[model samples]
Target: MSDTESRLGMPSGAGAWDERSERWLAEGAAGTAGRAGEAASGAEVPRAVPRRGAVDPVKALMHRHRELCERAVDPLEIAAGLEAHGVTDRTAARFRHRDVFSLAEEMFARVPRDGDSQGFPSASPSASASASVGREWGWALWALLPGALCAAAVAGLRLTEGQTRLLVAAAGVLAVGLGLRLALARGPLSRHGAPSAARPATGVWIGWLLGYAALGDGLLRTAATGGPDTLPTGAPDGPWPLATAPLLALALSCAPAAWSARLLAGRARRRLTSSRGLEEFASAVRPLLLGSFALYLGALAALLALCAAVLDEPAGYAPTLALGALLLLARLLTAHGFTHAPAVVLTACASGEAIALAGVFAGRLPGCGFLSVPAEELLDAWGAGSVPALICAAGALTLLIHAGRTLTRASAHAHPTPSP
Candidate 1:
């Protein structure tokens, strides 16, 4: 055996097979084909070898395929590669499936815990994994940058212009697109064949894009009516003064969060042993829930603090509070399914409707706006027309339950044993 093969745990004579077994397989195969083809063709037709893509089948067997499959390399592909490269394995031919699998088991065992060798197992698994991790973190920062800027814009710069808000959202979209491309191009996440079907199809993406565009247009139209720096009268004029700025920042932020989740989930799926994968995933749910809560609360508190400092009007505090609360709820809830379209639509629509209802009440409250009214009057009015309040309460409770369950799972993972 070659030093490389021995190191890979490949048997000393994997290429050897019993002469009798080889003859038997060859004879049997020809006869079987001959019998099967008798009704269609007078003689057996020769098989055509496939050398799909640019890589030679021989070289692919030597290297790349192992990387593609990770440690779970396929035995049949090995058998075919051997046949295509004119190396014979009597054990592989006679057993057809068994011997190749036996070889795969040995090769998989020989595979270095960290990819180190060039032939039997991938030479770059560790490097590829490290690269993937680096890219994920880099993309996370890509997501963080825009969100931080948007939050700052809302708090200090005063995000009042519709076009500027669109531009921010566009930058987020661009980052998400670039990160996704980088993830798919090299190492760790790829498949030997086509992409995984678990992700949404192109049509689904198109539909989502169309829906988001329509939502953006409606928001733009709403802002246009106000004609910049003006309010819809009684609507909160502080903290996201244009009313749609929070929504725009939120919509933009979803791309990064979703991208990160998709990458993390995919990594977990690809890397973890099936036995412990679900358990680990459940553990992660709590951290995600906590992070989402922290993000919402932190952003709201910071923005509210800035509004108090910058606006310098006590009256400005109330509207800012109302706006901040609604946006916070929407952001926290929608984050649960940010990686998926259907979930995004459902969470967004539900939260958006609830917040819009609050806006409606504000627009039509007696004497003064609902948000502008005193707390006692607002509570009394809520008591008088309590159906909407009930709906909002139910939705909020549902989301709370989800968050609580996620936290529980996280806590379970964190404290697997009781304290003494």
Candidate 2:
């Protein structure tokens, strides 16, 4: 049957469609088949209406900018996508040209409620520590240069001045440098750097004196016995122990001083916690008190023992021994005072120097039997001559201690609120 007849009608005894209806149906079917084929090929698919400039130009620029940003930012994208509509090209570029950190923050802020796509990155601890240590070392080196130069000058002078003057100057410079370094390291009294204030200055001073005595003794012995090159200094039988006896006596005298300092340290810590300004002044002095007592005890015992041991020698040596002990004590006390109790340390220091001068005067007195010179007369003469000196020393110490205290109070008043 023709296509039109098949579509139109069915014949009797064998089904057939009418020709006109079949032709109309065939045309409709052909049209549908053409459309279906076009749809399958995407030619007849519906197109989404394009809104004029709907895609942000800033976002396009940022995407392009990543080519540069990617080189710098390894694991993270530095530039962020711009979403605002009316921003100028320049403004948008500036916003996109931020660091990875800024970009990350911007992205985080923009993507509110987005899971796991926002927040600041973790800091690199190792890198940060390295940077901090590097900076600290740089500053430390700069500060140390002056002290190092002073030390070098003193050390180099030994050949020119003979050992005595050179040694004295070197020791003085060393002590001063140490004091300065310690002060700087501690910082202003308002902000001391050390954690353990419980360590009394008095105790520290005693220890320092003992140690210094040992060292000085060893050096003197080395010089006296043989050239330092051939000497075995580290041996226990070394000159240090022998030299340290007088220092030990002085130290023993200062034993009670250390305990007193410990008490002072406790008080200071309490005051400091309350944001008191006098923390440093009090802390510095408290230690000195304890150290003074210790020094006194150590020095007395060491000196007496030494005197007994060397009794066979001329009795005059007793006074000389006393003089030497006084000198070491004076020096150690001077250093400690400068560090922690500038006034008291200085007064103690001056007294020691006076004692040394008296010994010198006695030694030089014409026809004055050096040992025969009564100890009392010697002391009286020194007191009479050194009266003004003693007064000046005492006054200076008093002023320093007083000023330090006043300054602390003033600081406390200035910063009423404690720093976090």
State the lDDT of candidate 1 residue by residue for 16-50, as single tens digits: 22343344446656765665677486665555333
lDDT at 251, model 1 = 34
lDDT of 1: 0.38
Clashing residue pairs in candidate 1 (N, C-alpha, C atoms within 3 angstroms): none
Model 2 Cα displacement at 118 (Å)?
Answer: 32
Q: Write the per-residue lDDT of candidate 2 for residues 246-284, one digit (tens) a residue.
A: 333332233223323233334443443342112333455
Model 2 reaches what TM-score against the true structure? 0.25
Q: Which stretches of candidate 1 lie over 4 Å from their true place?
A: 1-130, 148-300, 311-420
Q: Could you tell me how far off, in angstroms, the CA of residue 145 lies in candidate 1 after the best superposition?
A: 4.1
lDDT of 2: 0.36
lDDT of 1 at 322: 33
